[model samples]
Target chain A: MEDDYYSIESILAENQKIQCTFKIDVPDMGHLDGGNERDIKALSKVQVPLWMAYILIYSDYADFTIPPPFSARVRSALNAEARSVRLSNLVGQAGLWYGFGRMIMRLLNDDVAKEMSDVLVKTFRDRLPEVIDQAQHFASVHASSADSGVGGDNATMLFREGLDGTERELFALAQDSTRRTKRWYETSERGRRS
Target chain B: MALPTPLRASVTPAELELIASEQLVEIVPLVAMERTAFISGAYGPLRPPTKCKVPIWMATNLKLKKKCRVVPPDWLNVEFLEGRLTQETSEAGFSEMPFRFAEVAKVLLDVAPDDFPNPDKIRSLLKDIREARQAKSREGLSKLDHSELSLPNLCSMEINEIRPFFIRAMGVLTDLVKEAQPQQDAP
Candidate 1:
């Protein structure tokens, strides 16, 4: 639980940094960042909030470097061992991660984003059966143990029961992902503000 | 004002309202309105004596306008809810109910309690169902402290009912995690 909390917090911090991080070619924005240099070729990476990033991305004035967990590393991880990793954080903060990734994918048409989306879908579908099996088995064993007195044949399963809500939490996260995905298509027909 | 409840899952009256909006309500129209539209798609041509499938909102509006008499959902009856409560207790499960049961019941009972022979019976049954479910959730919560590694399958309503208990359990679990963290970090 502590590890999850720490990892989630660290992930959140990284996301926050990314939200305020980007590379823009605009000159007016540099003056706001307290830089004295007013040269035309002084283009450098700057950290700005996502709201500003959207305008830059939309105007085709800036290039968004794909942040961590949405990178090729995660794609390789999915191809390797997706289960050991906490995939819920990928769709972090009520679909912020997925929504942003999707928006970036659409805006840039980056193949990396495309691959990430494919791997996410595949990984989620693959993980579903195992998660359901574990959840149901854990639930039944817990129920039976409660019914019985001391111990049961499924004593081995009891160790997995108190899993800090990984399965159910992921279940909810997956549902949120589905909903966000639908909204993406529904509202994407509009010019990307919805 | 009641305290807002903490929940593990996102379930609320809003979901019930979503279900309620799709429910088939029986309405007998007094004023003939030909296929009217009201946000949630087109519905109408409400004719009297010929019962039609109207959404709950349309039925409510018709009832409010003194146009059509809204035949409350069949499950809204006192006897039915009492049966549901019994079933909920005996089977440790619930039968499918009309969405927004509590909200709709309160609306109907508040507006036209006289339609039923004993309105208080229905209210009491709803109260009992609520109380019993809350109590059942509390039972699961009470045992949470005894075992650190137990996961309980709580329905949405039960989760809402056990909000405070859930917070307490979370606090305990957080402390436990904190206690375990240092040892693991000490390599």
Candidate 2:
């Protein structure tokens, strides 16, 4: 699904950078590293966009390392408590952590790919319940406050700030449904009064 | 411009309520009337003080004009809803309810609160039941997997509330699963 051409999320995920170590000397591509050198030296590391890295890595031009978002520290942190990790901060500004991880998984070999994919799935599964709870909580809070804005305590705001793109979408969906249900309840009561 | 949020694929609570209005309800007529025909079906030869089975929309229309009294469905009472609430809180799964129970109950309680005994208590009981069920749904979602999730006896309104979340979550799961499969096959 991340491969969908029309999906803006997928596009942003592809635009994310992946650090690759060059296996062959490539002239004129030193600009990728923002260096003045005319040729990218063999064994030199350079950060390339995920989309371009996919081709270069497959065509035997480079070998990419796991990006900082999926590093061992993040892995253990996720294992410790998946809900507390701030996924939005992990993937820089776009906050497409899951999508970026999936794209990176596609570029890896078998055993490592399986491990990375499992992390993505487990993190998403672990955090989903909390995401949904906050959405419903905010929905009711929004309803009762009656245009007082999307009101919630500091904890909820802090938690919401941690959501990745996919979880953000799910949160929006759940909040919307709850709001509609609240509106329906109110209108039904109005119908009774009239 | 894109379609409004509620109009996108999933059914809204209001739309579900409209559909629930088609359900047949028993009403006590104040004035006699001949059988009437409509697209859905023909409903009845209502007689004074005599009961007739008509769709809820017609019942609401007649009740609004002071022509009839709606007979609340059997399960709308506080006693029955309280029983369901106990079952919902005690059980791990959902209790069986009328397929459109939420929508129908809201419509009935809205259009004809006077017909039911102790409408306030019933309303509060229904709210309690809903909260219990929602808690169960969240628990179910916590165990969600890429393969399947079975939540039997969920009513229409409950299903609609979680539909979008479930669909998108499953989509992501499928993507993850599909990515993992080829790796296992290759090695």
Candidate 3:
């Protein structure tokens, strides 16, 4: 997500669909495909959801022109230099940076990927660490200085009334489990000894 | 294929939580539940052959009574999970998988290792993938920036190691998004 600054959600929601033609028949695989039950025949053009197209294309099922998003063009226009980290993040923020980058990387096997694989690698390699650096820097501030807005808000930020991402919830649960297990183990062991 | 909403292209923090919480196992009642009440909540008037989502404790209770066929979650089979483990290890990104896949697999292996064709192999493979993913996470954490940090080719266990960074990132992300949002009141 941070790679280029794009979220998968934004990419999936905002991106336009393109026509793709299958190289093989995609039999009725499952219900997730929005009720397209019939086999997608080879050599026939079908308008596909870009997300769906991504899967099919990767699996060697079909092909399409994967349009470089505006974020892609931003990176391309800036000569792929480190000078444009903030600029690219600004633009990539519009579309979720690394997501678009990773999506393009996923397309590396596609014909287009042949020409600019280097750009994709450099796009991430050069810029990604910096992106992480920026976040980590901010996180560091948030972690230490209580006067910082992020730091001061930490308690309320957590335990706020809303759904946290799954991992946060899970981590808390794991800690809770560990505490219980330790208590039980200590109690049982003490009982056994005494 | 894209996993359902709760699923992700990679192993996520949720997977670990789900595993820790323990996923439901399929239980076929040898005797009718007949709307029986239990501590967790109201359970079946469940009939035979129909599977009920039962906790491990309850499932064991049923087994003791010889009351039901306790079919493990679908991923219990060695054949099915071996394929998933292979994908987790090999694929650049993984398909959506159940939340507590690794933990459930562990439980099933511990409880009924006999059910699987190759429980030991599955155990070892899962461990290797986990270790490899943890290494990647050390690399990933050194470079963390976003809420959705892609644990490329990694597993959920690694997510636990880096939860603090991600949680902070998420908080920052929400704030950034709010800041970035154009005010409707402005021209």
Q: Best candidate per DockQ, number?
A: 2
Total clashing pairs for each candidate: 1, 0, 12
- Give per-residue CA lDDT, model 2, range A1-194, as digits (tens): 45778989899888899899999999887788888988999999999999899778878889989999999999999999998899999987547999998888887777888898889899999999999998888888877776665656676677788888889888998889888878777675535434
lDDT for every model? 0.49, 0.85, 0.48
For residue B47, model 2's alpha carbon misses the true position, in angstroms, by 1.4
lDDT of 1 by residue, A11-81 (tens): 33324333323344454445644577563233466555444566666655656676675777777876786
> Across residues B10-113, which tens digit of lDDT does each residue of candidate 2 receive?
88887888899899999999989999898999999998888899998888889888899998888889888999999998988899899999888888887788
Highest lDDT among the candidates is held by which one? Answer: 2
What are the chain A TM-scores for all the models, listed individually?
A: 0.52, 0.92, 0.39
Best by TM-score: 2
Docking class for candidate 1: incorrect
How far residue B45's Cα lies from its native spot in candidate 2, in Å, is 0.8
The segments of candidate 1 whose C-alpha lies over 4 angstroms from its true place after superposition are A1-194, B1-22, B89-99, B114-117, B143-158, B163-168, B171-187
lDDT (tens digit, per residue) of candidate 1 on B44-106: 777777777788656665566577776767887878888888976876534456535655565
TM-score (all chains, Cα) for each model: 0.40, 0.94, 0.36
Global lDDT for candidate 2? 0.85
